[model samples]
Target: MHEGTALPGWTEMLVLAPLEWMELVGERLCVATCATVAYGAPSLGTPRPPAGMDYVRAYVLDSADTRELRALVEARIAGLADATGARELAGLTVRFRRLPPEDYASSWEKVWKPFRAGPFAVLRPSDRRALRATDVELRLEPGAVFGTGRHATTRLCLALLATRVARGERVLDAGTGTGLLAVAACKLGAGRALGFDIDPAAAPHALHLATQNGCADRTEWRTGGFEVLDAADAEFDGVLANIYSDILQAHAHELCERLRVGGWFVFSGVPDDHALATRAAFDAAGLRVETERTRGRWHAFAGRKPA
Candidate 1:
């Protein structure tokens, strides 16, 4: 179910499977899990499943590797069928259709509707969902980079931001995918927000999101990593890093240094099993853990630099 501009040369693939199989499939495929129902998009239509089969829909991004990806997915489906002894499931089907070039943007609009994460509600600009008086609505568009606030790691970070970001503070968001966190910080009344990512493609996407949220003037997006954090530029009152566990562990000391004493620091993207070690690394760097939250198998931690 893709809704986008009629762009030529892009293809969208849809896979339908039992709801019970989605977790295993997501872990194996390395794409979003249960994306079909993650947002508030109105149901396009439900596919009829076999007797007693509860179905969920998922998507594979259109990319150069898609063909190889489909082959791997089909192979996994075959293995699952054999393991479950459900021979009928061996023939799991996937749907593919070419998207018109102009429709690409509309396609994102169709899926990324308004959804709440703690006090924040992430919505596309066109979303009409009712909002609570206390809700901070973040309007964004899907981008090539991650961090749209849908993933567990991003949500945990958002929750911390909502609680800890004071008015008129400075924020530094490391590996700012889609620039969502930086924009969210600005929306939360941060005087200035700076974001940097290793991916060269991420700056534009993050900058665009900052603009979409009307915080472009308060946000700066750059491409690179910790090198962007310089003493001459000034330390931040809040720092966010939603990158992987290893990177966070590796840079724990430097990240803590980027924040002023008593400032907030939020780190996520650590799997639950590694949370303890990640926390210890920060503790060693003089940051004291103040909050920890987990969703699914991912863990998020919020700490503060000791004054």
Candidate 2:
């Protein structure tokens, strides 16, 4: 999908809310709309949102029914504010406007230019000019998290996998946002891979990406969280997760159980301050922390399940 092509009746809804509300409100908006959402700190030359507001942009199909959909979403967010004792949030508004398809795609293509993530060169299909013969190229779909490999946490996970993943081994990718890690594992010569996420919307898109990357035959995607795993399903030689620190600690044991004895597990999406506690949780889960990778405030841990 090259940028600047005419795409009629497309809309982008931009929401600028407090930075602290980005996660809370962003997750709600994502779950409710199932649309592509992007977040970032406001910068100069950008429309100044209220002080310290993080910007979120959601893309949706423009149609006759869109007005009603937008209203219902506004009401839902307003109701959330009331329920959370944050009635001040009732003042928050969702701005909806027609977006030029080319502009949208072009904007993303600029920020999401091809970048090396460990041994893989993560690129959009439009970036064929930069392809290198020796690099493992991952052609990703634009407009979503996880798929682009833009996050520091995701980069660290990829770096760890470059060292640990082995050819012909089976792997599990929990909280598989774009299923990038699973597809990358297959690209890295893993025999088979399973990717699942708590969000039902992720599986279909992830599978689509697997097909685009020519790894569909080797990858299976599903919707579920830790409960999706079974004791009998402990055949995986490796596991990967890039999830929040709290959730990582809570599910450390179950995540480890999915790996075979002596199998590898790489986890990230943790802030640096939480690294010690997260490592301790995994250590108590019968895994030994072999290495830790940090990028900015984010941290990733690579561990080996006990034999």
Candidate 3:
């Protein structure tokens, strides 16, 4: 799709496969469609798949070449069975449907309702819902990036930040998707917060979010990875990281070094399967794990840097 061009509609393609093959199928779909892929059940509102089977969905620009796309997807699926020797993959099928013309940009707003995360009430920029007297308001426009406060990892990090962020503290948010954590820290009374992500598109979205939340002056968004922090001094009072377990483990020492002595940190987005290994990495970096939280298959850790 061209930049800024209005989409007429979308051709939605769904591939049905078993649970174990969903990820591989989703990857192949992305390659075939040259777009992002999502995994879920066949039902609209259902979050998980039925028993062992799941659906992988992708969208292509509505055009006359849909049949070609379907053929390519089928070929990819067939190749998967040959590559993995999993003959069951050969049974997978790709279904296509043409969606009506509508504004796909704002369509998500119809289903993304406001929700509370710890002391903060997370809402869309256009939501007009009334807030309670004690509610700390956070306005977000969930673009292509992550950290919408709906994900369990984000909520867990927010809950931990609510308890740990002290007034006038300097905060660092690594892998700051929509700058939700950094902006939230500023809202929670932190003096300054700096957030960065490897995705080049992340900074603009995050800056807009900070401006919407009235914390742009106190928050800074940058485009890069942890190396962006290397030019600065090690003076952050708190750190927030909601990223993959492998990335967290790889940068544990670097993250710990950025904090001041006895400073606090919140680390989340680690699946339960990697919880023990992640904990070992944190401990190896000299962080004292003070609290551990789990929701579903995810885990979050809150702790402090030792003197």
Candidate 4:
């Protein structure tokens, strides 16, 4: 799902399973097809499933391997049913159909409207809505990469960045999916911003976003992890990370060391179950947690390096 790519024809895989097994079936389907799975939900005009049965669907490119992939999906489902003793799954089968191609390029433009994150107004590339005089508008194309400012964690980070970023300060965005935070930092008056992610596809998408937001001159994107910033003397006035809790804990020290004394940081994507441990890791890294925000089951933290 890279940016600016045409929507190719797809082979849709649909399965009907009991409500209790839908999630499990979806997970196995994702593992089998290496693609996103969609669980059916009743729409306003759509009828609900029969009793406890629900529909799970996944898609694959309509290519020569479609038949082979279908076989693999069925085998995986059978294996999962056997392991869990779910007899219903063993008897279930995948219904494959070819999806007609349409103008998906403009599909998002029709559905994705402008949204706000603190003082910033997040909009898609095609959105041309008017805004307030003080609005800091960010034009972005999510393109399969993360951080559209719609997620709780991303919004939390944006709010923190609005309050913490200072004029002319250098900022670092680790795991900078879509480079949303880095672009936001530049718009917030940061003198410079550096962003890096492990996914090679992230760099181009992020760069495009930075350019679209008119912050390309102030931001740099790389296609690697923390190792990309290997310079020993490299330091930033602010750091942002919206990554998993376990990865945050593992690299807490490295991330903290890259921030100058008295520098600020916003860490997010920590589930409630891992909030306490993540906070402990931040503390161990000498980051004094000054603000904590919780939305739904996720937590985000704003803090600074102690002298």
Candidate 5:
């Protein structure tokens, strides 16, 4: 738990692919692969991708099996490179670096230093200033979503919350990963912002984040799914969920139901490719899309409840 240096085997580079492709290959040599940033794959565009035909660099993980991973990449990904007969996606990248022993403590500490948004800054409270944003700040230990401000989903949610947060509006955050968005809601103007997640470990960090932002009393976070939430029976002015499309789609009806009549709903963490599927689910649930924004491979779609 003490500070340490990062590792030295992780690889990183950009990967360009056709806009039509879905779910490319990743390494099996490692237990998990995190997407540092996959840039330049927006869902909507008429301008063709570059014909240079080579992605600049790609970050990949192999853990102790770097050699095997390289071999697999050569046989599979390299072959795809050869098949670049199509030319629509050519500037994707994931700048990755292996975790050094101290990487967990140092680099993130450095990374969090520049997180500035509206009135929000993410910091350790103990540290001088790990994250510096707007008036309301959120402190996180840097877990699932990395330093917290770099994901497409996070950006999209922040934009939506900043726009509509109003005095006395009750807010609910579904699948509140890292608790960044929920903290944001408090600063943006929601009288109360409650967050829900199935992972119990997330509660403490979320609690700390809310406390750091001075929204601890108004912001309540707990461990449970929609089932537990269903019992509350109270409606909210807005609901924000930045989770996988599949899960969101499953809870479409319930998510829509949690909203007060004529209220707002903001959702993100959806890959660009899955927008259509999400749209379909929302449509099926009697929701109407009010605004949509996309960046790289991520998208945010907001809907209104017949207001």
Candidate 6:
């Protein structure tokens, strides 16, 4: 479930979930999703040295009904032991990709132009302005990470954030890749906003956007993994995590813990096929789905902790 070095056979997990799971596992855990029968290493990153005969882990769930689910999952694996369709094999196994850390660099930019949304103004560094239902002000910019206002996921998140970010509401952007969501929350009337990202490039880019959006004081940025999220102590009126699927499921617990009662959590960056699984995980975490928005194959779900 965790590792002390860069994981091996991580890319194969991409078969089971979207690319985001690797991000969610943070600096721990190797990847081997249901999509793959055998494990592999991440294609990127400088893989760390092997753990020396410390074999990776494999787990099998014993729920009565889950046997079917496991069978359904294992059937999708690329290779397998004579499965004989054994549902008992329904579980995950990650093989350490005996390597060093690889690098993941996001190529994004800011767009500074006159954009209008309702009576408000925005900078449309992303194509998100095109999806606007009402005229709002915005500026565009290049970013380190992709998917700001221009991406469907980000746009959907903005639409939902607009409705809930009342004046003085505290906001958090869990995977603040570009800090766009946090800035949007601030512009939408949130009292304050903070962002965190696993990638080091995230903070500076996000801070720059915050300053450009005139929310320098309203938005704060941090560097660290989800574990660094402990700084939040169940604070935040709204949270946004526009990450891929596997990581989303892995962090479902931390996300629930970080949200305040009656607060909202917006999740995006999921592929269409994984929406139900993602929703199921959120429900299992005790968060209530208040709104659902989808564009193309991506879905943005808004949920809340019980008030």
lDDT of each candidate versus the true structure:
0.75, 0.78, 0.84, 0.82, 0.65, 0.61
Q: After superposition, how far is residue 80 of candidate 1 from its true place, in Å?
A: 12
lDDT of 2 by residue, 158-242 (tens): 8899888889999999889888888888888998999989877679878888998998999888789888877666668999989
Please tell me which model should have the higher TM-score, number 1 or number 4. 4
Candidate 4 lDDT? 0.82
Pairing residues by index, what is the TM-score of model 3? 0.78
Model 3: residues with Cα > 4 Å off, grouped in runs: 1-103
Best by TM-score: 3
TM-score of each: 0.73, 0.70, 0.78, 0.75, 0.69, 0.59
Candidate 4 residue runs with Cα over 4 Å from true position:
1-106
Per-residue lDDT tens digits for candidate 1, residues 1-307, read 3545333354444445555455344443344321222321114565455554544334443553366666765666557777767565577665555544544434555555467887888888877878889999899777557776788789888988888899999999998988888888888899999999998878998888888888899988889978876778678899999998889999999998888999999889888657899999999999999899988678899978997
- The sequence of per-residue lDDT tens digits that candidate 4 reaches over residues 237-266 is 999999889989999999899999999999
Tell me the tens digit of each residue's lDDT in model 6 across 64-174.
214354344345432322332433323434322222233212211212234333243455544453544555444546543543455567777777777777788988888
RMSD of each: 5.5, 5.9, 4.8, 5.3, 7.0, 12.5
Rank by lDDT, descending? 3, 4, 2, 1, 5, 6
How far does residue 31 in candidate 4 sit from its true spot (Å)?
4.0
- Cα lDDT tens digits, model 3, 5-100, are 766677777887887766568667765435556666534764665677878887777764466777887788778888878888876777778877
How well is each residue in 136-241 modelled by candidate 5, as lDDT tens digits?
5555566543226656577777777777778878999988866888888887778988888887756776887778778888888888888768567489999999
Off by over 4 Å in 6: 1-134, 231-233
Supply the global lDDT for candidate 6: 0.61
Count clashing pairs, candidate 6: 53
Q: State the weakest 10-residue window (summed lDDT) of model 5.
A: 22-31
